[model samples]
Target: MRVGLYPGTFDPITIGHIDIIRRATALVDRLVIGVAINRDKGPMFSLEERVAMLEAEIAPLQQETGVEIVAHPFENLLIDCAHDVGAGLIIRGLRAVADFEYEYQMVGMNRALDSSVETVFLMADLKHQAIASKLVKEIARLGGDVSKFVTPAVCDALYKRLGR
Candidate 1:
């Protein structure tokens, strides 16, 4: 089976993320959404919280696409996570050229780490192209309505986390 790994912080999964996950399902037999804890950035939700939210948000989509979706929490390198999940490909979502340079370097490093794992980039849908987790959290933190960016559950979680 062609298994793909889509790893991200997913502090809160946004519609853009949903778009990528939905699109990626068509390419792989099983897609594992690896939610890694990025110690570099302070996230709004805990790892457990993020995993629960991801599972909740993806449940319906899993039924719709018929592609097995699993959320995993990883603390080590991304390549290791891919290996653990038996992923032959690493799926990444690209929003614009600005995201290219960074992701390009990441692909190179990931390749160097594991030559067996190939990287695939999927452009975000136009409607969600501008949405980002950081921006979504920022907007929500400042009391801006982010209902359109994230799901209702995530929106409520964000507000609750921010003590709004």
Candidate 2:
């Protein structure tokens, strides 16, 4: 089976993220959405919350695409996580040239760590290209609506967390 890993902080999975997940699942038999728990970044959502949100958000697509999808909470080395999950490819979403520059270096490092695993980049859909988790949270914190950027469930979670 060709398994792919799409890893991200996903403090609150956005529309842009769902777009990437949809595209990635079509390319591989199994696509694992690896939620990275990086405390240094101070994510708005807890690891458990993020995983639950992702699982709920992707459930419909999983059924629609007939693609095996799972939420994995991971820490430590990303390459090691890919190896652990038996992933042959790592799926990444690129929104702009700046994203490619950072992802390019990370891809090189990941390749060095595990040459057997390949990396694939999928461009974000035009509508969601400007959406990002950080910006979404910022907008919500300031009482701005983020419904366009995220799902209704995520919007509720943001409100619950931000005490809106």
Candidate 3:
């Protein structure tokens, strides 16, 4: 089976993420959503919460696409996480040129570490391209509506987290 790893902090899974995941399902039989446990970032949501949010958001996509979608939390290197998940492909979502600059360096480093695994970039839908998890959290924290960026469930979780 062709397995792919899509790694991210996923503090709160945004619609943009869902769009990439939905499109990525077509490329792999199983898509592992790697929820990174990067303490350096000081994410708004815990690893458990992030995993739960990813699970909740992708369940319907899995059902619709008939692709096995699983959430795997990892604190180790992303390349190592890909190997752990048996992913020969690493899927990344690109929002803009800024994202490409960072991802380009990551792809090079990951390739240097493991030549066998490949990285694929999917462009976010134009409407959702500007929707980022950090921005979503910021808007939510400032008492702004984030319904357009995230699902109702995630929006609720963000608000509950911010005590809004």
Candidate 4:
């Protein structure tokens, strides 16, 4: 089976992420959503919460696309995580040219670590291109409406987390 790993913090799993995950299903039989446990970023949601959010958001997509989707949490290197998930392909979502520069370096480093694994970039839908998790959290924290950027469930979670 063709398995792909899509790694991210997924603090709240924005619509942009959903768009990528939905599109990524077409490329792999099994899509592993790697929820990174990066303590350095000080994410708004815990690893468990992030994983749960991802699971909730992708459930319908999995059903719709008939692609097995699993949420896997990893604190190790992304390349190592891909190996652990048996992913020969690493899927990444690109929002802009700035994202490509960083992803380019990452792809190079990951290739050096494991030449067998390949990285594929999927550009975000134009509507969601500007929707980032960080910005979503910022808007939510400031009492702004985030319904357009996230699912109703995620929006509710963000508000509940922020005590709004």
User: How well is each residue in 115-152 modelled by candidate 2, as lDDT tens digits?
Assistant: 99999999999998899999999999999999999999
TM-score of each: 0.97, 0.98, 0.99, 0.99
Candidate 2 pairs with clashing backbones: none
- Model 2 lDDT, residue 164, Cα: 81
* lDDT of every predicted structure (CA atoms): 0.94, 0.94, 0.95, 0.95
Q: Is candidate 2 or candidate 4 better by lDDT?
A: 4
Pull out the clashing pairs in model 3: none
Which 10-residue window of candidate 3 scores lowest in summed lDDT? Answer: 133-142
Task: Give every collision pair in model 1.
Answer: none
Candidate 4 steric clashes? 0
Model 4, span 1-164: residue lDDT tens? 99999999998899999999999999999999999999999999999999998998899998899999999999999999999999999999999999999999999999999999999999999999899999999999999999999999999999999998
**Better model by lDDT, 2 or 3?**
3
Stretches of candidate 3 off by over 4 Å are none
The worst-scoring run of ten residues by lDDT in candidate 1 lies at 38-47
Tell me the number of clashing residue pairs for each predicted model: 0, 0, 0, 0
Instruction: Give me candidate 2's TM-score against the actual structure.
Output: 0.98
